[model samples]
Target: MPNQTTFTIKLETELKDAFTKIAETEHCSVSQVMRDLMQQYIERHEYKHFLEDKVTSARASIANGQSIPHQDAKAIFKTRREKV
Candidate 1:
């Protein structure tokens, strides 16, 4: 395992109690639950930005008339599958 770092965090009583209950139900420590939740939150935010960039690029492409027809897309996929 990589080296671990420690930091102090404060949570509301109700939120702390809720996390404790979930940790108990999941057979894990509260710290583990918080760590997993934070990891998932970070990944989700990253993916959101990634998708936003893709959408922005696609919109620019459409505005510039750089697009393929639906049938053309289907034919391209069919040819790719056949090649594979």
Candidate 2:
């Protein structure tokens, strides 16, 4: 891979062994596996933060009683769509 930065990471002995075995089985280097895992980890971390924000917004709306009943909401949307 071009334009890639390298870094050293410490892993538990057992975890290192497992990663090495997986790399061998997948016909790739441990470094490649770690890179893929890190990418997935970062993506999940970002998505988690987004979900947290959404949860917080929902909680605030509930606390402020700024919500309509679910059935009323659906009916309103249906009427709006029909008008559109």
The residue ranges of model 1 lying beyond 4 angstroms of the native Cα positions read: 69-84
Q: In model 2, how large is the Cα lDDT of residue 27? A: 100
TM-score of 1: 0.72
Per-model C-alpha RMSD: 3.0, 3.6
Per-residue lDDT tens digits for candidate 2, residues 50-79, read: 999999999899899998889999999999
C-alpha TM-score for every candidate: 0.72, 0.67
The stretch of ten residues in a row with the least summed lDDT in candidate 1 is 1-10
Model 1 steric clash pairs: none
Residue-level lDDT for 16 in candidate 1? 83
CA lDDT of each prediction against the hidden true structure: 0.91, 0.92
